[model samples]
Target: MSPSLKAATAVGVLLLATACGSSNGSGSDASGLNPPDLKAQEKLGKTEGEVNLIAWAGYVEDGANNPDVDWVSDFEKETGCQVNTKTAASSDEMVSLMKTGQYDAVSASGDASLRLIASGDAAPVNTDLTPNYADVFEGLKNKDWNTVNDVAYGVPHGRGANLLMYNTEKVKPAPTSWSAVFDKGSEYKGKVTAYDSPIYIADAALYLMATQPDLGIKNPYALDRKQFDASVALLKEQNANIGEYWSDYLKEISAFKSGDSVVGTTWQVIVNAAKAEKAPVEAVLPEEGATGWSDTWMLSAKAEHPNCAYKWMDWIISPEVNAQVAEYFGEAPSNARSCELTADKDHCATYHASDEAYWKNVHYWTTPISQCIDGRTDTQCVPYAEWVQAWTGIKG
Candidate 1:
């Protein structure tokens, strides 16, 4: 989708969230906790045998490339702790599955981590416990989402933005402003698409940076009452232009296939899957900047295999594992050493691992709250709390 169109639609339709509060991989609502006691879990290190993990689709795979790629196997071998995993399609699912208190760790996106922290479903990560913590880049370290009131909940993993991917054949000059999708000029009206998540409200915030600079929105996830109201108004206007707001990865691919969408907000994985199918597509990091999420490995507040979780964090962030995962996933690696280890070190370069400028403007996902966009500081802005309620009302 064009940046403007995506931004405009993002403002309108992104906040449709429905979370299932189930525990484990099972569909049962096991345990309920209002606020997770991370301290209690911190003290329960490596006491349990089987570790349950809730994560995204590709974050944990079927162990295709390496037998050891399945983190569960490697953890068992090293710490004698068994591993169990349940895949979640969205952050809402992660929250629901974690409610049962069956999973020891969860891979939460910025949008979900705050809810997890608030509910006391997840625990603060003890950096000292994981040896690999030292290798983590400061750039990705300690954000408003994972850290609340100075305590961190998880270790940083992989990161990327919700960039625009398009078929070069359709548009000659690349799209810089979010207007490509928002303006909905006669050219690509019904053919456009966007993400159907509430968290995407930030994309709208991003576009407003250029169109409505008077609001002074630095972070899309962060907003105050007046600013938030402006953003919602902008979104309501963009909603009229949207054809289909996408949630599933495959659905986005199919939209591109039918030529129903010429441009839209997409991830590296979606682009990779399309390329694998020989689809005509191209991804661009728009000039007005972008909004994205970084997946983190956080220990559960009720974790039984703390040692195993720590080990897995260290092992995965290692140069070798980072390179393998990045190459296979088609996203940039957070580890600097991964570039040196990869046979085709150029992949890291192409992904812009070394460029400080590119990432300087990229806003990592963070849930907006009453206090701040990331809920880290007290400085005021439109909090996501209001956005959620407004979005909830809209969906209802």
Candidate 2:
């Protein structure tokens, strides 16, 4: 199975098991709750000798998977901070793990970053402490996903879109819009797949933003009760057409190769892998735009190895290292300098790493809250916890 697939399955199982749980944990509470009062580091300190991290499967490679692919070793050797990593499969799991205070830092996606900030699990980053942060794409820095109240919470890592992948041999006429797997999804019933997680609700909401503009969904993540319900209704309708909801890349690859799944959502890495295996597949960012992720490397509020954690953040985003990881993980490097270091001359162009215009319509995942992230003050928006429950019901 692919790393992304593993992440999806892990997320799917966890979301199902914790579906009934309250979103009120930490950041999901009623409006007016403030993030924990934690200050960013003011100065660099002595190395703490070690750092523990919770990251997505492919983010922290130390050569265990492949001898040729190892970035953690150099980080450990350079900083003298022994690197111990825990792979988190889902955003909720990252949030849950951070709450324990056992780890020093995490590579949080937009969906989990806010919850960590609101719950006080993550600390505001002192960008000054990590000089490499200055080289990150201006488009990624201090955005709504990693910054709150004008404070930076983490260092931007990388980003990618959830593209529309279809079997060229099976899906005809070529799809340019998300409707291929949405309201018109029934046209390819029993052969469609989708990412299996509550975060996927935002994809439905994104579609509604274009197809049903009256819903007034200025932000897919900030859906009000009505908009949220409509998004959920769309998912429920889509469930019948889904041959399998995938979080595992291997399964989706197999499904497409075996002719069980012809069209649905996917990552660029998954498409690359499938095509390399001789699967007749192609992926594109549809006309309605798409949902994507920009991961942040956040320091834990209660981190034991602050100096070492800060060191890792800087090293990971450095041009050479960032290029290596971004290429390995198949996402655009957040650092602009990394583009020149990539082995594939076209890597940046292929992923639109520096294309600011291309990302204008791609909504990054963010935790939904009652206060409304989209700037509406008239109504309370649905929180992520409710999204979890609704996702469970829709799948049922």
The candidate that achieves the highest lDDT relative to the unseen native structure: 2
lDDT of each: 0.63, 0.82
Query: For candidate 2, lDDT tens digit of each residue in 35-75?
Result: 87889999988999999999877778888776767899998
TM-score of each: 0.81, 0.92
Candidate 1 minimal-lDDT segment of 10 residues: 20-29
Q: Model 2 — TM-score against the truth?
A: 0.92
Looking at candidate 1, what is the lDDT of residue 285? 83
Model 2: pairs clashing at backbone N, Cα or C within 3 Å: 5-248, 5-249, 8-247
Q: Which runs of model 2 end up more than 4 angstroms from their true locations?
A: 1-33
